[model samples]
Target: MADETDEPDSAAHPFTRLTPDLVMDATESVGFQCDARILELNSYENRVYQIGIEDDEPVIGKFYRPERWTESQILEEHTYTQLLADSDISAVPPLIIDGSTLHEFDGYRFSLSPRRGGRAPAVDDLNTLEVLGSHIGRIHAVAGDGGFTYRPLFGLQEFGLDARDAVVAAGYIPAELMPAFDSLYDGILADLAALFERVSVNTLRLHGDCHMGNVLWRDDLPHFVDFDDARSGPAIQDLWMMLSGEREQQQNQMMHILRGYRQFNHFNLAELQLIEGMRALRMIHHVAWIARRWDDPAFPRAFPFFDSERFWSEHLLSLKEQWARLSEPAIEIYD
Candidate 1:
């Protein structure tokens, strides 16, 4: 005799459907409550409702299925989250469990922080870039010594990109890129390893996943969320991801972030360049991971640039057209 209500909702994890009752139960029975509405699901992440719905909760609830991450990954997030909060920086902070340890539930990692309040201010928007750059600089300014550490978020073996490697290892490169795959991955791996080695490893907490998406405009100020990837690393490493999206000469947007970071930390020209290389690495690593996830329906159409093979080719052509516009070479950031 089974009361249907007593049975756990079957839709809670990957390959499973999660019902509203399930989220309710997880919130009520586990520790806290987040009145969130299911908004949308992307390739590897879940974005729930936010914007002060359900009794003044300022943020959305992002619940990550373990299929997408391990506990260690979540723990690293918690570490940097603490650093941000401790340093008085505006970063997403995970709610604590029993006065310590971030709350986790449903075999997934979860964080409920202020949703960027409203629409994201674009990088091209005037005043937006300056603000974003300033905020970013503030974050970077609190470099190496300020409540951060340097535990590698991605390891040589478990870069969280193993799936991508499988595809390439199986010769999955696009027809046009076939000959380049071997050399590219080899070069990327070697470069990452060398940079990883020579960079004087140090500990400084940072918002692990820093990028345009992680920033939003709320009350005319940039509100950053998604500290799930927070960890110990060169403080400058945090800024590189956002910086790599664009180059230095045309990086007023980046300069705002850099200047903001400078309000708290300082780096020499060489260090800044090195950090920029790190950012490029991060992009390559993620682009690889995204390629492997092409099977997932929600994966971005053609991330890191385009969505389809045709679009990809077009993008390459555009890059060629803009080749002169690209002034600097790249290194590595995250992967």
Candidate 2:
């Protein structure tokens, strides 16, 4: 399993200063009496914990990565989730404390949420996929008008063009492997740009990162957590990651999902064409994410494979495979 945990290595990382006592105190500062039982959750970009309360259920404390988001950008995410919750969507919005959702204590910005618990959904189950699709459809229905004013857009410039530049500048690629890396990357980017130009998609506020890892399965439904990556983008950005397995299997999965999806919002057939391109962008952006954060001690520990030539070599091959996938006809959705 990948080291998704984000525990920092002492003062070498910003979160090094976020001690257990501080975590409990931060929880208490928000009006809850801590029982001194704080368990760190699995997260990398930010530190999250489940804190026990004196006479109540435990609550979640999410300490935002310092300087990663401005107050406005964070609040916009809060408001978007609130919109979804208001529409009967199963979204975990932060608790409103002292008339505000955003709070700060001891130089750290954090928010408290009622702790939600569930196991990851069985993505292969057709019923589960259908249920997941309905929830996402409802989310998009509510999100149609609540476009974020401060959040970023999921697009080529940030995820593709800038990502390509960052990895090259990070100097992680072996000098000998640079040519293969450059050729594959440049071709992928050019194709991605042309693909984006070809498909005119309707962008809206989205969960931004809606893979199975961020979803919790309870009450036979999908509850979306971590709108941290929430941003304005095409609706498909929220849907594609749920798909897995071979081509026919993924198509069957999409069929079930859209069966529930189209009941709420119109499913644009054109957006289907961008799935591979979107996948390519996510691939490139993910590596760039690791590269940009390499300076953070925890990142190296979690992604040790990244330090090796074998990793880059495998990454290039994966990119080559994805590059070929981009040329194939988009997966067809049938009745």
Task: Tell me the TM-score of each prediction against the true structure.
Answer: 0.67, 0.95
lDDT of the structure predicted as candidate 2:
0.88
Candidate with maximal TM-score: 2
Tens digits of lDDT, candidate 1, 1-335: 11212322334425244455555555555444556554543326453533234565544556665455565666666665566668886776666656644455665455655454545667666466657667766665543554423344434344523633654553334567544544545555565566556555444666767766777677778777766566555555665555435454335445565555555556443345455345444545555565545444345433523333554345334433333232355432221
Full-model lDDT, candidate 1: 0.52
Model 2 lDDT at residue 280: 90
As a TM-score, model 2 comes out at 0.95
RMSD of each: 8.2, 3.4
Counting clashing residue pairs in each candidate, in order, gives: 36, 0
lDDT of 2 by residue, 115-146 (tens): 99999999889989888888898889888844
